[model samples]
Target: MIAVGRIFRIQQELDCVALYFDRFESFSSTQVTSQVGLSYDSRISRLQWTDFAEAIPKLCCKTLADIPLIDDSAYVRELLQHAVMDDLLGPANGPNELIKDMSVRDRYLVGKLAPRETLDEGNDWGNSAVDEAEDVVPDDLEVKAKPAPPTAGKRTKGGEQPKDDEALGKGEPETSDEIDVSKNQSLVPSSFGITFCVDGEAERIEVEARWGRYERIHDHGITKTRKNKNKKTGKEEEIEVKVWQRIPCGGKMVLDLKQGPVSRRSPD
Candidate 1:
């Protein structure tokens, strides 16, 4: 059964890597023909295989003769070491960067392991990795699925439950269980509140608790907009977005739009 499990997992991993290679090939072809928005060079082939190299050892475990099936941490360290060696020989900076250039999973793992250093490093990542990293979406994109207008109201036995439409119109706070914290910055605010838009304009207001500081971040949401121009007509239009904010929140309050009209969208 254990052997069966290992084979199954290995098969799945290979299948995923094979699919990735196929996609990269397709993307490469599109680049050559200018059909795709982005272009990828032949070097992308190397980055794609790097992920498979890390997985193979783990999947084979004791079956492989060269390396033992140590803990995941040990395996990851070994993989990083080998990757670094390969990059150094090829005139690249290090293996860690190349590993991150491989796939999202590898990138995230590398991100976690690498020390918090200067993000704006002046190095030639050969355009391919730079484009790859830029194209990669952060894990937090999943958090955007949260409902907008982060209203955090508690339920009561005797009182009426608020309706969703009413909440949307009222610009209520979103309820969330995840606490928002930055690995590099301090998010501790003196006050808390919800943010939204009006007449295609965005605004944020403080929700001063009548009681005290609500340190608990229940949930949050956000709305975004983008501008696009017509290729043929050269006309521009604003596209509005209502995304669920993944940030941490503790309380809710009724928005006092009478405070002022939103002149423009404010960054949080």
Candidate 2:
């Protein structure tokens, strides 16, 4: 009975310590304050660590946007540290909700907790799935972007010019440098225009090639890439999708298609 009682008391003490630390963190940092009288009346802001304990509760449920106007107080820093630890521990009062509710600036500090190696190529190291796809990145490096179709300014109305609005407005205005060029293109029939293997397994698909810059006016539109294979010879070929051809992140793309029969090679 005594041992159980002692354990309860220790737990209570620990809880109290945590609470005190949470509250103390808010006032621990240096703050900017308005300076008093000069020979000529002028307002100057001086930095000091002031009454943080009193000021902290005001930010109890506030976001990073709600940080005191003066900014970067020791108390706030400590509070943020405690909040991060709490988040990692999945604690109830370590400001996890408040941190989540914070503005972009505060969220940046949280994001910093992630290691540099994990964020090397905008890779999300925080997720376990990315860690598993270690081999995908290498294969991605081999693929290159497909060349854009002739631009609108370059298009002249003559011999083999496009006959329709849809044909005339093929590729969109997105920067080609920003786009991901695909490897393995296929050309096929109207019903099944192309054929290519994502993981080496054949996908009988269709491709759409476009001329100049085209843009999608709204969301939820479908853009198709076509490819085809000779059934008898099994010689596979794919025509490029001229409008917007981008190879997705190899790791993420492969993971997304893991349930499918073919697993895509890692991309650069």
Off by over 4 Å in 2: 1-17, 21-73, 84-150, 153-160, 163-169, 172-268
Model 1 local distance difference test score: 0.32
TM-score for each model: 0.18, 0.19
Error of 1 at 236 (Å): 44
Off by over 4 Å in 1: 1-108, 111-127, 130-135, 141-159, 165-268
lDDT, residue 178, model 1: 39
- Model 2's alpha-carbon lDDT is 0.31
- Candidate 2 has a TM-score of 0.19
- Model 2, position 29, has a per-residue lDDT of 25
